[model samples]
Target: MKIIVTPSQPYSDQKPGTSGLRKKVKIFQQEHYLENFVQSLFDTLVVPNDAVLVVGGDGRYHNRQAIQTIISMAAANGFTRVLIGQGGILSTPAASHVIRKYKTFGGMVLSASHNQGGIHGDFGIKYNIGNGGPAPEKITDEVFAKSKVIAEYKISDLPLVDIDTIGETQFAGAVSDQTFTVQVIDAVQDYADLMQSLFDFKAIRQLLASGFEMKFDAMHAVTGPYAKEIFVNRLGASTDSLMNCEPSEDFGGGHPDPNLTYAEELVKIMFAGENALDFGAASDGDGDRNMILGQNFFVTPSDSLAVLAANATLVPAYKNGIAGVARSMPTSGAVDRVAAKLNIPSFETPTGWKFFGNLMDAGQVTLCGEESFGTSSSHVREKDGLWAVLFWLNVIAVKQMSVEAILKAHWLEYGRNVYSRHDYEAIPTEAANSVIAHIKSQFSSLPGQVFGSYTVKLCDDFSYHDPIDGSVSNNQGIRVLFTDGSRIVFRLSGTGTEGATLRIYLEAYEPDSAKHHLDAQVALAEMIRIALQISQLVEKTGRVAPTVIT
Candidate 1:
């Protein structure tokens, strides 16, 4: 084999977001589009001698081709070994775990989390550092800078290695006197073993043995195989309890997001009034986000994080107690109250797992989560969907109580944070910017303004100063705080491929147990109305209702 150096030109739109670079499948299929970005990343990295690299994706469209290209490039780029998931598949969290488990230089995760999948649907790629976490902004910035001025890329002339089977394939170096290796592995084994080491499998097995029924929805995405291995083969769950547990390149013609809007089938089963199952959970496309539910009840992600922190001692790994907790700014303050009760510090950072990675690496936080149906602990840098489900199961086994009962008891002790998020997706970029601009125009006069039972106390764009690194991240989101602990937050999301997404977050603290049973929509009706009025969202964007409500 010989090294091939091809001249290439830069693509101006290669800047990555808090997540990574995401675009429509057609955009990535362009000549040298994916190659340019990957080569830019390689150019920005300092490869160590005999360095190992991990490569995998969610088995979406174009995944195999992208992996083949990356592998050939790795050999030419001086990488000694590459560990890839069998059949070119690996969930985001699983890829992160593999990177940390093997101490690889870094890993490339090819997944557009919770996005649609098809020939015309979304695709993405991100770099995870050796810490098993998303690359910090510093590295991403350098990669972006390199991408802007890249002139060529390096690749080997060797044939593509087989990624369908679990085995190792070796080849001579393209330019050096070294050998390169590609090893395909069972993606579920390492992640499952880590789960067993963290929770009490025996107790959970007993709970299932006692006829405790539950259901897991993989939404035809990557988590299908992981759930099958962990919940069925390991935990003895019947195959009937798993829904959409088949991997699909197009996600079975459905959006693989685990929200109530997309996972309606699971919602119907869990909220069947009386004949509902004991528990129900669903994971997103790449298996990094999770939604938890009980018989006739839905648990908000904010509440889920608080409840987990409150009862983390039930699990064997966290039996010694947690160090601290952190949450994204858009998430509710429920976890803060739990942290106060546990006497552990709580941190609020901008939206991203990299921020939490910093705190965890410094031994400042053990559990961290975001409100977008994502939660996790120190066990893995990225959010683990199956791990969160197992954690809830372990807690249920220890308490020997129903999911509703546990949540009610938690609310009785820590009070309820009635919260909801409204997403207006795929709107024109200019329209979304108009809404933000309109909201910001009133920031100067909104403070001390009175509106019904709520009075505005603060209004500004949220910013964060990282305590560990002292780096400041500004323009996170817009916030309007009320004296009664009610909040309205507005931000433009970068997760979508087309246009822009305007997200409005409404939250209110309810300390009274009597009002805890009210529906979140009803509890925050006034606040939502005020939020719409303040931002003039409908007038600015011509959207009568949000695309999805959570």
Candidate 2:
């Protein structure tokens, strides 16, 4: 193949965040801005000229344009084959699946996850290593470093080929003498097949058909196809049961996040009637995070994982029960109790899915979750929002109970780990840093300090040393553990590209079944208030309330 060299443009701010380089679409449209980042990603990879690669996005705005750019650059960089999803759309989980299925060196995923889409909204580009997990810190650091000084990016002036139909096309140049193949494969079949291998589809179908009402909201993003395939076609749910079952470039002019604040439409519909929907769920833009609700009742993500672990036998994939359970440091300790009872190891890690990859690879952990509306098993490296929704359906199917009944029964069995997460989003970066620093300063002498009614028993920054890889992450979050098992954690999220997000997680475990009836947010309100005061967040940020309380 003839070689082509395109000079890299002068582009700064190509640094990758927790997941990728996410920015407003307009920012990415700047001259050579996207190309520079793509070149940097290629520069960081070590693959042969004949290596195959996967490319796709969440069907967000600019997805096709970004894919075209990546394809040209990948070709210029001597990649032999590129397997792109049909129409340049692939859910985040689907991209991981394709990478692993093809055994590609790595893949480039364009998505901002649960954020809004459109010309004015956010866009992102992330490179996942061959293991189908997000690139490790070392690789991402190298990519970022190269991006800062990238001179230009190479691309072939290939014809504007249509991606809707799968076929092959030639670029018709010295560099394009080779064929740039596009395979318009079934986007949902492989992923659905993977889900089938992990869970019993017949059980889920029975649950949906046996007088159980479920509402699955796709939020007009990438999960629509997956949900339609699994829920309506395979699982026998009614056609109208799935909401927003069409993928829109602009996500239908709404934020695609599944949290209560963003997915208010679903919440309202579910709680509108006395005979409300039994099981209600929603997934984020790229379908990696999930929000689970039962009629008018919202099952907090922390509790959701614990309930799933306690009733793992309902799902055939976990029939043997989870080998081990893990949660982010900020999540409630509900699953910890389950792990203790089952005599399985439970771990606490930092707030990222990458942290769980090592444990999963080692077969030391089968299930893990974060407080940020995410849960997954070793079935895949990334969280599967739709999979979690199906898991809940299977649970209800085997138990033959309403959502409320199942949750009530769980509370009676495991008690309640009342949990709440307060997110102060887009605060001034300096102010957020100051709040964390203030919290850290109080750590050494805070162990025995008394505030109002509770006395702290232990205080320190949360850290993790992955048992499998021995990688350490210190200062994951700031924690104040009370003698009574009440705890508060403060951390700045690394996901956002703009201003900082201060996440305050509060948990109060009630082991007594008698007190399990209390509301979770109400029980943790006082603790959150105290945490805000101690962290000096209110005074520093000039905001007395969190942007979103989950």
Candidate 3:
């Protein structure tokens, strides 16, 4: 293939956020905009001339076009080989799995996880390190610096190659003489095989065939294929059990987030009228986040993790029992009680799945989760949404109980961790910062402050030091602990497409069975209201309500 070098204008809005540089699709359509960022990635890495690069996306809007551009750019930057997923589609976890499986130098994953799609919605470009985790601060900082001053980006003027077929295409670069090969491979089989190795499919199959009615909603995102393979093909689930089991470039014009609000359709069908779907679960875009529900009963992510840990032995994969459990600082402390009882190490880290990578690597943790509807084990660095869902299935199958029965049983055994998160999204950046600042300033005096019925006992900005790498991340979230074990946490979401998202996480641990009947959202509503009042969020943002309450 002939090589074409394009002189690209400098584009400056390339600084990566928590995950990657996500913006409107129009920004990526600018002349040499995507090219500049791709070049900056290569330039910052200064990788070997013949190093391998993995390129794929979540099959979101512009995924194919972006992959083509990246492949050409990789060739131009002297990469010897690029492992492109078949059809330019790979879930985020699947991309990480491929990166590690092939031992590639690193990877570029195109996804705006849990964000809306379409020409007017969000698009993202994230770089993962060779370890199959999100790029660390140092590398991302370098990429941002290089993107600001990039004057030219090299790309071969090669014809658009079909990425759906499994084959290799060789191309020559303009600036370099080295040839590059694009190798397309199936995206789902490897990930499915990995899942098989981790869990007992035969037992899960028995559960499915034993007349357990279940529902798995892919949300029309990237997990459709994986869920179909596992649920319908391997586990003997009926085709009707899965919803939206097809991948779409535009996510079928729906936001592929699996939260209650975005996934109301699935929620309605699962809880439809007198008769309800037995087991209900949904995975978000990129297939790394999941929301597990049971008919009209909702299992908070915090409670979900605790229940899973409490019953880890039921699944053959965790038959040996979990080594330890951990959660993000903002997550409820319900798991901490289980960890204490089990006499296992429990850690509280900052938000973000990358933080768990070190713990998993250190072998100090086996199961870890975040309150943001994410759960995973040491099986993979990134959270596996489907894996968590299947885990709940296995538990239900082994226990021979309905979803509601299992949750109620769990509550009877471990009491309840009433948890709720109020998300004030798209707040003005300044106002969000002010809210955090005010919260931080009051920490010293908050420990003794008395609200309506509760008195603050502790307050601090959460931080963590990874045991494996010894890397420290500070100021993860602002937390206030009340004397009665009711706690509230405040943090600005780093993954938002616009402005800032102030997330208020509330948790009240009820040790008595009598209090277990309290609804989570109602139990924490007043505490969250007090938190907002103290932070002056309403006064500053001019909005009295949160955009979404998870």
Q: Model 3, clash count?
A: 1
> Candidate 3 — which pairs collide?
4-157
Better TM-score candidate (1, 2)? 1
lDDT of each: 0.93, 0.83, 0.85
Best candidate, lDDT: 1
Candidate 1 lDDT, tens digit per residue, 415-490? 9999999999999999999999999999889999998899999998999999999989899999999998889999
Q: Residue 181, candidate 3: how far off, in angstroms?
A: 1.4
**What is candidate 3's local distance difference test score?**
0.85
| Clash list (residue pairs), candidate 2 | 7-152, 7-153, 8-151, 8-152, 8-153, 9-152
Of the pair 1 and 3, which is ahead by TM-score? 1
Question: Going through the candidates in order, what is the number of backbone clashes in each?
Answer: 0, 6, 1
Error of 2 at 94 (Å): 1.3
TM-score of every model versus the real structure? 0.99, 0.95, 0.95
Model 2 whole-model lDDT (C-alpha atoms): 0.83
